[model samples]
Target: MRAKIYGGCVSRDILNFDEAELIKLVSYNARSSLATLGSNNAAKNISKKHYDSLLNIESKFQRRMVESDFNNQILESAGKGDYDLLLIDFLVDRFHLAEIEGKLVTRSVEFLRSGIKPDRVVNTFSDQYLKLWKEGVDNLFNTVNNTVGLEAIRINKVYWTSVATNPQDSMMLNEKWDIEKNNAKLDAMYEYVENILPSSSIIEVDKNLLVADSDHKWGLSPFHFTDDYYRRMVKIFNA
Candidate 1:
């Protein structure tokens, strides 16, 4: 497949680190103030300034990875013409899922689920889950386009229907309504797709379909999902 790149504020290769050592350092420093943590060299006698710098660098790296991954995934999906069904990871405050509308342009629909804040849309998923969704969208877009020549679908917005209080709630909802929400989201998504997809296509999915879910935890900001949730969403989009 052709590779595409995304643009973001963070630099590339920011996450290169010794996972074990980094984890150890973080665990040890969890209680320490930045200044004290800096002086303690449990992982290595790295100065406080250097240690803090490394943490900041790692964070930036992660952010860049998310941006690049998301950009590439969307482009690949577009190229393959899989615009019918799109699954997004968590939506966080820093990463605005709405921004996707610019690229999709009413071609597709989005289904969103969150584990913390239900009032606003957001959720968390593993990086692997995010990758799978990206792949699924890519395949769906490609298959539909190849079978019948037409414009590819574009995802509108992810649906946020239900909320979860904790992991247990999340699991229960996923088991109970995952498929149902998928169908609902698909229905809502089709509305957008119908308006945007070419009129000549023999195979078509509905455009107005979407499913939305949420969690119990309140978001730090009313407009954004938590950082962890946002990261998960980025991974999904990118994957």
Candidate 2:
């Protein structure tokens, strides 16, 4: 049976923005009221074209924020915290914590019936399985994007159906799902911070502000990864 497309897998278009330009626009908006910014007479000192550009930029930025929130929800639900429950919800359509606990009970029973000791099996699985599962899921997501029409939908539907029907196998295939989830979340958070922050905000200032400070003041020095000023900004934001 084909699995219904869970809202989790639906891809929504995200707005792409130039961060530096967005910062400039925000500064401008702060300095002037929206009416003044839109008024031909008030903004006459600034090119009408420039004001119009700001409107376009702001609209796109707003759209991006909505898209970002949607993407975040999807990501968080996919396999982040409580992902097991999310998967179970897709499987059973009942999201109560007790229901999920019950599913776990069922799974444990099946595992024991199959002659696998729950404790032994859990301990024996390695982290490598989770890595492979992550790679597989990413590949499937990318493939869904690359293909089109009924073929893409059918492939995704079957993939999720297989996952739902074989919960124990999926769990076994991704033994360290929790760890992988944390890693993926950290990577996404870092990317979000990197894209939004300003370069100057993250650079370490020496006592004299003349030399780069080498001390690991914030647990990890931002400069360790790349000298790219923007990356330093991301580290500062993360810090």
CA deviation > 4 Å runs, candidate 1: 1-65, 69-177, 199-239
CA RMSD of all predictions: 18.4, 23.9
For model 1, how does the per-residue alpha-carbon lDDT over 174-221 read when each residue is reduced to its tens digit? 566544544453453345345645544223222222212243133211
Q: How many backbone clashes are present in model 2?
A: 0
Report how far residue 206 has shifted in candidate 2, in Å.
25
Give the per-residue lDDT of model 2 (tens digit) for 129-227. Answer: 233223334433333334421122221010111121234544533452343434353344234323433333122322121111233232111111112
| Top candidate when judged by lDDT against the true structure | 1
Q: Would you estimate the TM-scores of all the predictions?
A: 0.23, 0.19
